[model samples]
Target: MSSAQVALLPGVQQFLDRQHGLFIDGAQQAAQSEKRLTVWDPATGKAIATTADANAADVDRAVMSAWRAFVSRSWAGRTPAERERILLRFADLVEQNGEELAQLETLEQGKSINISRAFEVGCTLNWMRYTAGLTTKISGRTLDVSIPFPPGARYQAWTKKEPVGVVAGIVPWNFPLMIGMWKVMPALAAGCSIVIKPSETTPLTLLRVAELAIEAGVPEGIFNVVTGSGTECGAALTSHPHVAKVSFTGSTATGKQIARVAADRLTRVTLELGGKNPAIVLKDADPAWVIEGLMTGSFLNQGQVCAASSRIYIEAPLFDTLVSGFEQAVKSLQVGPGMLETTQINPVVSQAHCAKVAAYLDEARKQNAELIAGNVGPDAQGFYIPPTLVINPDANLRLTREEVFGPVVNLVRVTDGEEALRLANDSDFGLTASVWTRDLTQALNYTDRLQAGTVWVNSHTLIDANLPFGGMKQSGTGRDFGPDWLNDWCETKSVCVRY
Candidate 1:
């Protein structure tokens, strides 16, 4: 498509034309260092914009600004109702600019624009509303206490939830606006100031979000963003003394690094990391349903989701039907730029990622694994890797075990549910899994037996505002949903008084 033919949100080009900077204290601040990261449009593998690359100094500046805000009680000082009002306005602003945010998400992150609108913009509004509503409802409990510390002394005890102070949220590249809100809303609802570091590759939308936050009357420095690489800015932000909490969503290895950095400060940390999730198809399941479920499950966001179910286990009896149906379904998906409403499989974020994912598929062929369906599309232009299905995968291959984070699927035949459970549970990652069956007993059995954080009966990737979404074990700790999830962003303070 020619530049003249391509359509964009009216605000997109105007926004991208400016030199992107680190967002701090409700303004765009130039990076102290001269380094800048080129923002790539994965669909065309073209440089769309350039943003300042933050170093440790910039991270320190952002974190310190957040600390000053927290200490000043600029945001946390607001009454629950006032805070709620601000957050509601923030959500409203986000909705008002929905077209532009969704466009930036699709342009930078390479998910379908329809998905960017529905899942990204649509879900974010609902989530923000839900989170905002919880603001006034946050409360404390008074407990009856019997104190023997002193003669004739009556004791009263209570526990209250307090914001955990400045939070440092490290978001992954996929679902930038949606997941960034996942981290931001809860922290904001809990009355904590935050400094978020977006994935350098997809930092544009969040920068715009920061600007909108200020427009919504959020106090300066309460919501800051540092755009840079993991080694420099990320390490500094996670290790900063003033940041009371660190919430990261990324690879397990990087999660561990963040954990280690936060551990030094004894800062609270929440990690939602990598997964090699499993999807099981039972004998009683409809092959068509399995195919449809796996379409989103295995290939949503080009399989970049941490909870994406790539390793599929189908019952032996239903193997041929499910496999053949799935193969056709995979092949039928439209692979193209995310902006098109018809496109299903957009590129995998970048060419480097394309190569990394393709390497795994190449290994599958080297091991004589059956290529059921899929093709890494045209190499010269876009970073497109359409839905790929590989059968006859060996248990020992890296392709079988590692988190591919791409459009690659591996199907295995399981003799029974027990076999499925055994094979699925044998993974280092336990982010999420699903079992498709009509038998309530069989599905319920796998629900407990499956070694994953979130288990679905017949669905996958269907997230809600109330779901306590987090990973178990290597998938990482701390959830990001519900009132309980909001609590993770706060600290419990017990108050005792003698009267």
Candidate 2:
């Protein structure tokens, strides 16, 4: 390979340095127990590296370290402004190393470097910077009241946002760096110590982030990383007696499990789980714009996004036009190595995920759903599944009901605008949805009853650091971005003063 192509691959030394093992007390160390996990590059089906996979024993050490740091004067005694400065520096470090982190994410997550650089790493920087500013701004308001029995008596009561103790942040594989930042940045900004458990498949970038965070002046043990499986280390973190909170971003099934374990000790939790989001296209919508929006919304990140518009409802009047445009858009997408700058759609995360998506396609075909474009996959070599589109898909079909988390979209034709809205809300998952209509009145009317946390009009899948992101029903609870995100890791305590 040429120098240019070598530059595209992950720097071996950087990868080894970052992917060493559990990061605790400001140092990288092996797991307490002898467990290991093999990381892979899904784009080429190659083994990237092996790292220490922490179990319950490792989780105990991490949580204890974090707890000690949280209560110690070294971290908890620091003023909010001081914490803000360190976080701002950390954000700058992330931006300075954005290219390297983007390459690691592309190598591990099987996402295009274009998408990783433009979206994932960019979003991480924005979140870190945004949260850095929010640290000093987190405050409570005072309330005035008079005693009913004693007219002369008065009450002065106010609330303070205090940091919860040790927080365990278990992030998913998709958008690993961005989601990991979402879980830890707000906690750190709120003056809480965190033990992050990055998904085993995509731990390299997150481990790199930990090093940068410490180098940026975050106190030792204030931010730790434990790379391991969810069943062991993740469960231990969530159920540990000392850990004050658990914030997880993964499947609904796993979220339920975590909630059950957290409930045992009555620990606080914020779960950002799965989504089978929908996109509703009304009759008055612009076909060109709506089609483009749907294509990007459903197929972006190879459709590995939790809030990706997987289920789409189009008005019958413009269904044919939208489908035709969508087919052309998918056909025009470039699928290749993630390091390639021009590739739009890369391989799925792993062979198992590719197989699951292929099964859905096969089942959809057996049930008589029409394949609109792209269903070519079944290879064990690279785990590549072409962006797939299914027309007139049944609502009960697995492809429509389940979260495929791949580049597969199901299109359903509705009678009208009202029917479009009705069909869109039929699913159990309601993370996000989009309305593509030129009529302002129709867009506003539809937006009011979308039943999802976010409703994008004339566009789709556009996220910002200032907006709160999460789901309503099965999509999961609690927000990930904005000032509100800080509330998830901190508890509000009311204090009263009488003079």
lDDT of 1: 0.88
Among all candidates shown, the one with the greatest TM-score: 1
- For candidate 1, lDDT tens digit of each residue in 175-279? 899899988999999999999999988999999999999999999999999999988888888888888999999999999988887777799998999999999
Candidate 1 worst ten-residue window by lDDT = 372-381
Clashes of each: 0, 0
What's the TM-score of each model vs. the native? 0.97, 0.95
Candidate 2 structure quality by residue, lDDT tens digits, 214-291: 999999999999988877878888888998888999999999898888888898888888888888888888888887
Instruction: Check candidate 2 and list the clashing pairs.
Output: none
Segments of candidate 2 deviating more than 4 angstroms:
1-6, 9-14, 17-19, 147-155, 375-381
